[model samples]
Target chain A: MIEVENLTKTYGSYNALKGINFRVEKGEILGFLGPNGAGKTTTMRILTCFFPATSGKATVAGYDVFENSLEVKKRIGYLPENVPLYKDMEITDYLTFVGRIKGVSAKDIKTKVSKVMGDCGITHMAGKLIGELSKGYRQRVGLAQALINDPEVLILDEPTIGLDPKQIIEIRQLIKNLAGRHTVILSTHILPEVSMTCQRVVIINEGRVIAVDTPHNLTNQIQKAARIFFKIEGPAVNVVKELNKVKGVKMIEKKETSNGVTDYIVELEKGNENRKVLPELIIKNGWGLHEMRSVEMSLEDIFIKLVTEEKGVKT
Target chain B: MRNFYLIFKKELKSYFYSPIAYAVMTIFLIITGYFFYNIFATFSTLSFQAQMNPTLAKQYNLLNISESVVRPLFGNVSVIMLLLMPLLTMRLFSEEKRSGTIELLLTYPVRDIEVVLGKFAACLAIFSIMLVFTLLYPFLIKIYGQPELGPIITGYIGLFFMGAAFIAFGIFASTLTENQVVAAVLSFGVLLFFWMAGYSISFVSSSLVSVLSYIALTQHLESFAKGVIDSGDIIYYLNFTMLCIFLSLRALESKKWRG
Candidate 1:
């Protein structure tokens, strides 16, 4: 539903977006993951036709963002960062105004506005002025305004930035529910929001797309050595020495505890099954293994490693 | 057209709901009303002989009000408009740009011209309402005395065009800055220069005076105040208004491309 090719935006001396290239298939929820000032908002604004790119081409729903901006604009719904709203207007009134601007029929505006209000769960506050709403409610109202025209593509920038935990979960669930119907391209610094709501993730940093893959694949790609953690009720020195003696154990780190319990983290080379061998080795050594678990790498770890590591993949 | 109407309606509704519109209207009425009542009382104290024999009137009527008092008072109406119209229009695009709502507006299916025209129409409508309220001054003069209805009508026509020109200039100024105060002050300064330039023309030679007078908006308004519907003066005001609006549109487009 969206195609961007060598998209670059420069503001005087600074390049906000550096030749970004990506595509989103119809009905795919693509999460734009990046740290702050990672060109996420710039890319979103370019795609939505709010601004033109300095160099490069982008099209949405088969319409060029520059040449056919009106068509692209009609097809995409954008919720900008901070959810700019007229504070003096009521929630319903604001939605109606947005609907009218989006070219919704007068008769249909009422139904569509109410439907979006229900979808975002802000129906109860329809009569409340936007200034009087809580941050969570205001974000929901912004979402409702974006969704009122039932756009084909939804471009949301930090949709849940200021919301509380429960509100975040609610918004994540709401975005997830939009998966198959709306082609969503959301940019956020929150990694879990992407993992929960998006099927594919595009990791951008310093104005470049660093990695694009499924969250699981991203995690697996970064995870080289399989590590396992153990809390054993035994002598710490003996446990570390025996773990090092295990055939496939490449590295081990032991922790000293006053309770006579030893904690060790053991790393085994890839393609090695540490779980199947760990119990037999513990039995042979007469060491009591109180608890054992594989320490799998999470998306957070991969994200931090990818963003922090300087000389890695250029793509 | 439909999009323009929609934007226009929303903008107009915003004016009614916001305190700026009401505050400007109230302040405009109070100040203009005071000046109007004071001028009328002063006019009432004078007799027709005061105009024929100024030397005799200088003895009895210590305050010598001129036949020019009516025109200058009406001209002061333009000054009042210059101050208030900027306040009315300062939020036209500046507020939207500052709040990031301009992004939402631009991403809509509407063309850029629609947004500009919609905002222009809304500001003009509010200005028309304020002008309508000022009509009470003309009507009071008509009821209390037999003031020439022709010049009064033409004077109002001059005020209308002057207000339109100021509104367009104000909108253009508002487009330049996000802060309403800066927008208002800039527009006021621009309008004041044009207003005072007409009077300052006397200090220069007649040849250069005509050039400066042409640049002065009030000089064009003088023909309208004389009950003469000169197409040249009308076109001048229309062209000035259009130039400001065109500049405003260009500024908005530049913002989208450069900012």
Candidate 2:
């Protein structure tokens, strides 16, 4: 569990974290979604006790990060941005070293190292030097280092960055598996990564937290109106007039017309079953219905809209 | 203590894993060995001259092998250490900071002092090994002639402490920057300034002369090299080493304050 209350970090004239607040429940995987220079790494660094916050408090597992940093550090595993690692060390050796510093018992270090290597899918590269590995493997090695101690809390900054698409999927799966066992707070600029892996998301921008909610709720809260994409082979002018006459049909914008088919995006009022009404309306009009699908706003759209300050709802 | 040991082991292992340690040790040995040979050659020539002439023997006082050869050998080794210890310690913290490994290292449960001491111990260990290799010079001298054991032992103690102080300063320098070359050059300059500080005593006011001499790193080594183990000199080197280590610890802790 982690609690950050009004945590502010300032560097000279610039503020990296402007009194941001968030809480992550035990075994909950919280995604810290923000664009570049948005204080994600700075927040993670303060939580990891790499540095103390300029103001306010952050507690991990009931220990204050500033007052009881050693205890917090003992219970938390951090994978810093850039995945810093001793490049000359072998994979197993590096993991074992981290395990030792993380306070794993000497007798259990071997098992822990092997287990994490397996968990991160770097088992075959155990004997290879970290410097010799490719970027993806190096990223895995960094993850393995963080998991070596099996700490109660895991703080990962941009964990999937620089990995190939396949590696990224594998890592996301690995992190998703960690839910309900280890409390995870991973930061990323990638929007869908939050929707796919995190139970809740915290969207931050310009040193301030803009919104925090479940990925699904964020989309629903930001949409305001339902949008449906429809293709119909009908007279465009007459179809628009008839659709406007239907109750709860707010607007219909003609997207494009080609090959005698017109693509229309219909904005329907909330709680309206315009989807059920549209097909009958087209049939009565003697028009062939080509395609009809509701268009849900993806997390990507919500992210951009929130970050760009078009719409936001704090939870 | 356990944290210190773990960090120390990792640091020492890293040194051996990289080429810099081997390169520094070999270069240190080769250069020191050359100096040792030259000093010994000059001593041998002087002794041979003394043997051929009684007046020269009385004038040169060639019977004190410790003074003529062992003491100067230690002096040369100390100078060699002054040059090489920077190379050994430049990467201790600078490379970690440069490669961004310091982030993970600092976040570990280990205390800040433990990291500084652990790194200090590792560099001291490597310097000790280099010192051990130089024992061959004394061993050869012992085989060919009789050297006083007192000065040999005392000189080593002096070299050990002096080299350790050099390493501690180098570690502090390493902490000040993320650039290895900058760390190395900065430490070398600081050490050379202190080593040359004693020479400026005559140029300073009488009241400031003692201060300059006391702070000069080389002045403390002479007492040990001369077979006189003054507690004052011992305390000076110990305090110097501790001050540098403390400075390094503070530099490391500054991250929490300023970051």
Candidate 3:
């Protein structure tokens, strides 16, 4: 539903997006993960035709964002990071106005708005002024507005930034339910949000795509060759040698023994699940293995690792 | 056209929902009302004295409605329009930008001209509403004396063109910044420049004086207020207002790149 190629955007001397490429297939929920100032909003703005890219091409809903911006806009729903809304308007009125501009037919606006309002859990605040609504309700209203015309693609920037934990879960659940129905591309720094709702994650940093894979596959990759910290009761000098001899071991760093139990942090090559052989190896070397536990690398740590690497970003 | 229509409707509603429209309207009516009463008082006194002293009325053209009331009233009213038009148009694009709704508005399938024209039409609609209140003066004058239909109609036509020209410039000013006050001040400065352009003719060379008088916003209306509907005045006002609107479209288009 969306394709971006060499999308470069520069504001004067500072480059916001540096020739990055990514795509979101039809009915796929792609999580765009990046730290602040990672050009996430810049990318979304280009797709929505809010602004033009300096050099490159982008298409949404099979229409070129630059050449056929109107057609692309008609098929895509955009919820900006700030959720730009008219403060004085009532929720229903605001949604109606959005519907009108979104090109929703008059005969369908009432039914479509009411349905989206219900889906976003904002039906109760239909009569309330948007300015009077709390932040969470305002977010839901923003989501409802983006759901106008049953858009084929929904681009949400930081959709749940200000929501409380419970509201976050509710929004995540709603987004999760939309996976098969709409192609969603949401950019957020929250890792768990991607794990919770996004089917495929594209991690961007410094205006480049550093990682792209399924969350499950990423976690599997992290688990398969995770570093293991070992506290063994043995002489420190020989322990490093024996540990490095293990067929799958990539590197081993040893520290002085505390209470005579030598510590070793080992990073094994990827797909090395031969942790079962570690205890046997220590026994064969006459070393008493006091502790043998693999260090758990969470999704956040993986993201930080990929982003900090200067080149050879995993994708 | 449909895009323009929707945006125009929303903007029109926005004017009524906010206090700015009412505030400008009330002040406009009060200012116009003061002048209306002043003109009516002068008209009544002049005619009353004319009835009493026929020789005095014959000696002076003071008893004529076109000179005593019609000319001065529109001349002053156009000044009021120039001053107040910024208030109506300053928020047209600036508020949308300040509130960050400009992104939403521009990203919609609507074209740039639609947004510009929609806002221009909305401001024109609001100014027209305020201008309508001044019509009561003409109606009242008709009740007492025989107000010449030609000059009365042409005076209003002049006010419309002047108000429209000011509105176009005001909308252009609004597009230049997100600060409503800055927009208003910028509009005030531009309109004031045109208002004084004709006055600068005496100080400048003769070659430039003709150009200055031609560009002066109030100068073209002089023919209309005098009951002379010259094609020059029509073309000047039409082209000037259209140029301002065109400039506004260009400004809006540039935002897509500059942003």
lDDT of each: 0.84, 0.90, 0.86
Residue-by-residue lDDT tens digits, candidate 1, A1-315? 899999999988898888899999999999998878889999999999988999999999999999999889999889999899998888888999999888899989899998999889888887888999998898999898888888999999999989999889888998888888999999887666777888999998788898999877777788878889888877777777777877778889886565777778888988875668777878777777788888877656776788767455443
* TM-scores, each model vs. reference: 0.91, 0.91, 0.87
- Chain B of candidate 3 achieves a TM-score of 0.95
On TM-score, the candidate that comes out on top is 2
Window of ten residues with lowest summed lDDT in model 2 chain B: B56-65
Model 2: share of native contacts present?
0.94
DockQ of each: 0.67, 0.71, 0.49
Question: Model 1 misses residue B166 by how many Å?
Answer: 0.8
Write down the TM-score for model 3: 0.87
Score candidate 1 by DockQ. Answer: 0.67
Candidate 2 chain A worst ten-residue window by lDDT:
A306-315
Q: Which candidate wins on DockQ?
A: 2
Give one digit per residue, the lDDT tens place, for model 3 in A218-303: 77765556689998998887877877788899888886667889788898888765788888988988878788788867656887
* Docking quality category of candidate 2 according to DockQ thresholds: medium
Query: Candidate 2, overall lDDT?
Result: 0.90
Q: Please identify which of the two predictions, 1 or 3, would achieve the higher DockQ against the true structure.
A: 1
Candidate ranking under lDDT, highest first, comes to 2, 3, 1
lDDT of 1 by residue, B101-174 (tens): 88788888998788888998988888889889988887777676656677778878888888888888988998
**DockQ score for candidate 3:** 0.49
TM-score of 1: 0.91
